[model samples]
Target chain A: MNTGASSTRRRHSGRIVTALLFIAPWALGFLLLVLYPFAASLYWSFCEYDLLSPPRFVGGANYRRLAHELLNGEGFGRAVWNTAYYAVASVVLSVLAGVGLAVMLSWKVRGQAIYRAIFFLPSVVPTVAAAVLWMWLLDPGGGLVNHWLTAVGLPAPNWFKGVQEALWPPDWWSGRAAFGSKDALVLMSVWGVGNFMIIYLAALGDIPKSLYEAAALDGAGNLRRFWHITLPNLSPVIFFNIVMGVIQAVQAFTQVYLVSEGRGAPAESTLMLSLHIFLAAFQNLEMGYASAIAWMLFVVLLAATAALFHSSRYWVHYQGGSP
Target chain B: MIHDKATFRAHLLLLSAAVLFAAPLVWMLVSAVKPAGQLTQDPYSFWPREWRWQNFADAAAAMPFFRYMRNSLLLAGGTVVGSLFSCTLAAYGFARLRWPGRDLVFGLLIATMLLPWHVTMIPRFLLIKELGLYNSLAALIAPTFLGDAFSIFLLRQFFRTIPEELSEAARLDGLTEWGVCWRIVAPLSKPALLTVGLFQFIAAWNDFSGPMLYLSDPKKFPLAYGLEQFVSSYSDQTHLLLAAAVMFTLPILVLFFIAQKSFMKGVSTTGLKA
Candidate 1:
């Protein structure tokens, strides 16, 4: 009996060792790539460290500078506002557009697969290529969009050139600006809403047809049925899309970098948080300040995510009980 | 039958949306074949007056297109091999083993996905530089050997779906844990593995920021970054630019067509499960 017990213990220890061996690569990466860098970034946020010199502790200075700039509404403040505008506007629009497209694609129509493929194709285009294509498409002069607008006797806003006239014309049009780079960015984002549409399409497939049939039997029209049955069933996926959309919009950089000509030009109107942090660290060589901005962005994202989760209980419908 | 009017309206809306979404890409392709003079003079033309099929050749000549393509393929291939090797092993450990603190460690792995890349960008860059990989494609590819959080998570999920009886049977046949993972679990998870590989390939192909950060040498620039460089210099050559963009995008578009099922399944599964 003692021999049997000892043998089992030995086997258990062997299994543990084998497991460790299997996990070694990821553990090493988690430590070196993730954990160490995470700690270093937080520490660097408080220290002035250029690539050339050793870090010098300067507590609160970076934060203070960011706060000052944020209040002054020139540098960091512009970025914050621009990021907020882009993230909020793009996320809301994409969610709406994605759901609409997904529903349309889900309809029992001829050539459904072909339509879905056409819609999904754009999202697969590389970000750099897409940005380049859009830049040409939205060029102020000698562009197809402007030419079409001119042919149709409509006003063609200088898409990448003008400062986005806030609230559009007839409401709060300043007359000094037209649809600007951010608006163009929103258009690009909506164009690639296919990714989110795919998720919604999957969720829509999971919804039972009986619910829709019952709603129809009650004399409910298409819109009413969608509002009652489809909307509720889709709430969970909608919630997921909203959370992911916000996060992705906040991190949007490559397209923005390309569109704004790498410096958020045309009046800094398209400068986003990620681009701002990148320019701060890489361009200006202010690693410390950039780290601070990154930390703030992290905190804001966390809070926003947490708040969304909290609010989701009331809105997001679950088939089973809520977790 | 339910509502002919509603269905008709839906098809109409979907067709128009599809056209709107597809117009830019179609324009990119159409403009690529347009002569340089025709592009500026008649930018709104749906069809080119003169088919300048040689523009693609011109664009290819304008840049080190072949070199950039080679670098891109190398990076993508390296990343796929690295991610598959490392992530599969790690995922097996997480899914099949019963080690202490496994759940907690797995939680940490998932949480890593939530951590924004910006937080770790600077220090990671410095770390890569310290490792003497800076300015080389190795700087970008080396990290993939470690493992990625998303790929590991994906593989783990697939591994968990595999029946434990298979592993046990292999073990009873005197196979080691590694043997069981390699000979049993890996074979059953081909679809998942393919999903991970496809994702890694697309990511590597489309990677802009990695090259932007780690690589400064023009010789090592992948097509994604190299194409951007071409843009800055050849901004006036719109037809060439469009041709170049089309060239860069064509392979990915074709891959999407071939692997559409895997791509859609991977995306949808990740979303639903997450």
Candidate 2:
């Protein structure tokens, strides 16, 4: 009995060592890449640090600056408004467009696979290339979109060069003013709505056909059947898309950076939070201020996500149990 | 009869939507071959007056195109090798091994995925600089050797699906844990490994922000960043710009076509699971 117990203990210890060996790379990474950075950023948020000099402790200074900017409509204030506008507009439009496209694609039709493939193609285009392509397409003059609009007897907006004052002009407001750079960005985002559409398509596939057939047998029209059955089944996926879309829109940098000429051109109309942080840390060399802004962004994201989860109880549908 | 009519109408609507979705890509391809004069003079024409294939050569000559391409390939290759090696081992540890604190560690890994990169961006840059890897390709490639949350999670999920009996039998045959992982589990997990490899490859190839942040030298720029530089300088040369963009996008498009099944499966799985 003593011998068996000793052998078992040895085996347990050996397994533990082996496990550690296997996970060593990730363990090292978690320590250096994640944990250290997380702690350092939190600490730096309170101190004034540039790369050249040692960090100087300035408790609440950074936070006070951010608060002042937030209230007085400075750079950070502009970024907040821009990010909120972009995130809300992009998320709402993409969800509506994605669900609409998915429903259309899910219909029983010939060449369905081809249609799906074509729709999914744009999302695969590299970001830089997509940005470059859209730049030409939305060129204020001699661009294809404007050319088409003119050919169809419609007005052409100076996309990427105009301001947002004309997005929803009142009927009494009659001017030749065009949609602004952010509107141009919205158009570009909706063009890449294929990624979310793919998600909706997959979820749509998982809904049992029996449900549809049952509704049909109950004398439901197509609209009624879709409204009663499909919408409920799709609520979870729609919710997921909204959350992810918000996160993505908040973090949208590369394309925005590319389109806005890398400095939020056209009167800072396209300055976003991610770009603002990047410029602060790298361009302006204000590491401490950048850290503070990053923490604020983090808190906002966490609050938004929590609010979503709170509200999800009222609407999100689950098949088996509460998700 | 009513259903048939509805299906026909749906087909028509889908066909039109497909055309609209594909129009920009089609425009890109057609415009790439248009002469510089035609682009300005006859902008609305769908077909080029003459196919100026020489525009590709001009674009290539305007920049160090081949050098950028080589750098892109090297970065993608190195990142794939590093990610596959590190992530697989980490995944095996998390999935197959029985050890204390495993569940807690795994939860931490998942939580890290949600932590915004901005929170770690500055310090990570400083850390790489401290390692004396700044402005080098190594600065970008070295991080993958550590591990990634998404790749590890994907591989761990795959590893858990394998039968335990095989590993148990391998262990009873005097095979060590490494042998059991390498000889038994790795062989059966080819699809998952391929998914991770493909993902890392595409990510590295299309990575602009990394090269932009780390490498300042024009010689070190990958195709994605280098092409953007080209755009900033030669934005007026619409034909040449279009050609360069097409050249940059074609390889990724071809890769997607060749691996469409795996790509679609990976995308759908990640989406549904998330």
Best candidate (score: DockQ): 2
lDDT (10s digit) by residue, model 2, range A207-273: 9999999988899988998888898899999998898888888888888899888888778888888
Give the CAPRI rating of model 1. Answer: medium
**Model 2 CA lDDT for position B190:** 93
Per-residue lDDT of A1-323 in model 1, one digit per residue for the tens?
Answer: 99999999999999889999999988999999999999999999999988889999999999999999999998889999989898988998998998999989888889998998898888889999999998888888877888887788767888878676443343435444457789899889989887888999999999999998888889998889999889988999999889988988898889999988898888998889899999999999999999999999999999999999999999998988786
Candidate 1, lDDT over the whole model: 0.90
Compute the lDDT of residue B40 as modeled in candidate 2: 88
| Global fold similarity of model 2 (TM-score) | 0.97
Candidate 2 stretches with Cα past 4 Å from truth are A165-177, B272-274
Indicate the residue-level lDDT of A150 in model 2: 85
- For each candidate, give its TM-score against the true structure: 0.97, 0.97
Cα-lDDT of candidate 2: 0.89
Instruction: Extract clashing residue pairs from model 2.
Output: none
Question: How high is the CA lDDT of each candidate model?
Answer: 0.90, 0.89
